[model samples]
Target: SRFAYVRDFELPDRLLPGTFILLRIDGHAFKQFTDAHRFAKPNDPRGLELMDHAAISLMREFPDIILGFGQSDEYSFLFRKSAALYNRRQSKITSILSTFFTASYVMHWKTYFPDTPLRYVPSFDARVVLYPGIREVRDYFSWRQTDTHVNNLYNTAFWALIHQGGQSKKDAHESLRVRFAWPLL
Candidate 1:
């Protein structure tokens, strides 16, 4: 017997062709992973190199990817506004790109870090967001880059206080607050 059709079945959402698409992927529990692997603080040359290699592979694999920006454990891929890949399906686009990047990273891990074996398979999550115009997209990326810089500064200082200055986590945070004249706790 055939089942009855349901009205509330999965709804379909299609990204408009004229809008720019950004697919951002981030490592899952990357902080713990980094700590376990003893990744160099502030910047890990080998880790960055691995991410770059994976990104390059992603670009080469998908011609629709216009540009990519990556720092630390995240990468954002920019697709042309007119791209019709996978019929501009948000779920398909994000899932495929994220999995592909994770695979590439795993495949090239050895090339970057020979001594440290991958303890477990790393995974990533992705989301696709649309921007109505090029200006908005540009501003969006500019904002992201600026935030990255600011966060990097904070993290670098925090780690320095812990490592070099021999301060506890709470003391380091308080020190940063006092040094920067930040009133909020």
Candidate 2:
């Protein structure tokens, strides 16, 4: 029982009460994973479906998660302000959600990619952010949605230039750069 004193060394990570909690989980090094798996460019329906399935599973497991938004290799789960899950422990909430989501993804991978074999395990990293009110939450999700749209548009144009127009990768990038005059990812 003497060793129990070490628990005092653990830092406090309790989230603020009466504030919305958002947990965002993002794929770790998914570019390499996608390349190794030969996921379709621009958009992979199977991959998206797998993510959606995993999110749904997470929601079912944690009913306190009121909303989920996902795009590409990332997902955000919002918990109600009054939720008492884990007593609002930040580490517990983030770790559990990310781990559960990852497990669900792996568990259901075969269903989505029936013909393909998983070469390696995939991982996701998660962080918890608190919003003071509904306005901040709305703005946060709005930003994510806009980011998805912009990135999707860029990817579609870039891939089309290379795959359809037969332009080299460098040429396609240069074309988009010169035409858009905006920084690309």
Candidate 3:
């Protein structure tokens, strides 16, 4: 019962104008990862279980939103936050911490596997060095987070969706300018 599969996936039409634009900062060069190893296989017993855990965690944190979740050696997600309660300032604080934690996790991998081209896992929209043991732990934690779902901090799906429409960093800046300009107008 570690993992279950949903055979079909359908996107609601409203989201066409707004999808969680997904991107991944894969940690392929990290020391602890390699392409040769496996707990079982891709979509095999353990991998599937891990994916299930991650999905549940993301879903629980943003119950009303649709998350485009995927994982390979690394993980990625996207969500819409139009209805979220948190504002830009508080959200910014969490984003900084989230980056720190994610970076720490990736760097720690170097102590495990020394060499491999794990820079990307296009098939799964993932990017990391696949280590069975690490993945098992990661999956377990992901599942645990679901049972103990937090409030705004882990609602990454919502953040991703709000960020998707911008064309570049500059576009993002321009968008914010317009948003703030709205009240004045």
Candidate 4:
């Protein structure tokens, strides 16, 4: 029954009625998004225009999502379901399964964003949680953490994320140079 790993803390309840998706875009893209916002004059309409441009770009590729991007060294998404989505379970994954994913995101974000941390939300605050989905993720994490073998898969996964996830492959790989791989499965 356990299909995925989830953080033990807070998460959204009820899968978003519309398809919910999470994005992990390059850090540079996130920076551009924020920089444009910061440079905008106080209450400038250009700020909104900039946002509109960015949103259009993101949606041209990921059409159907109705929410804004949530960035913290990476991108996350929350949107209502649209019929055109290919991943029907995306809503469930982000609102619920994403708890575990955030542990990874927050950990990575901390390497740089220690000054500002991502807040953990409780499941009670979720808008549309169902009992069965909760049981599924809990079971998955239980089995994963309890596994007798410590393959250090988590560590490897993190390294891979940074190494392969960046725009400059060399720069991204450099991020791992001083760091030793320590898988804490």
Best by lDDT: 2
After superposing candidate 2 on the true structure, give the runs of residues whose Cα lies further than 4 Å from its correct spot: 178-185
Q: What is the C-alpha lDDT of each candidate?
A: 0.86, 0.92, 0.37, 0.39
lDDT of 3 at 23: 25
Which is the better candidate, 1 or 2, if ranked by lDDT?
Answer: 2
- With a 3 Å backbone cut-off (N, CA, C), the pairs that clash in candidate 2 are none
lDDT of 1 by residue, 53-155 (tens): 9999999999988989999898888998789988887788888888889999999988888999998878888899888998988987887787677678788
lDDT of 4 by residue, 38-114 (tens): 43211224333433344445555444544444222333333443433434453544344334333343335444444
**Candidate 4 worst ten-residue window by lDDT:** 122-131
Give me candidate 3's TM-score against the actual structure: 0.30
Which pairs clash inside model 3? 28-118, 31-110, 31-113, 32-109, 32-110, 32-113, 79-157
| Model 4 stretches astray by more than 4 angstroms | 1-41, 66-185
What's model 2's overall lDDT?
0.92
Estimate the TM-score of every prediction: 0.86, 0.93, 0.30, 0.23
Local accuracy of candidate 2 as per-residue lDDT tens digits, 1-185: 98899999999888999999999999999999999999999789999999999999999999999999999999999999898899998889988889999999999999999999999989998999999999999999988988887878879999999999999999988888846525533
Error of 1 at 46 (Å): 1.4
List residue ranges in candidate 3 displaced over 4 A: 1-37, 41-44, 81-85, 88-185
TM-score of 1: 0.86
By TM-score: ranked, best first: 2, 1, 3, 4
Scored by lDDT, model 4 comes in at 0.39
Candidate 4 clashes: the total is 11
For lDDT, candidate 1 versus 3, the one ahead is 1
The candidate that achieves the highest TM-score relative to the unseen native structure:
2
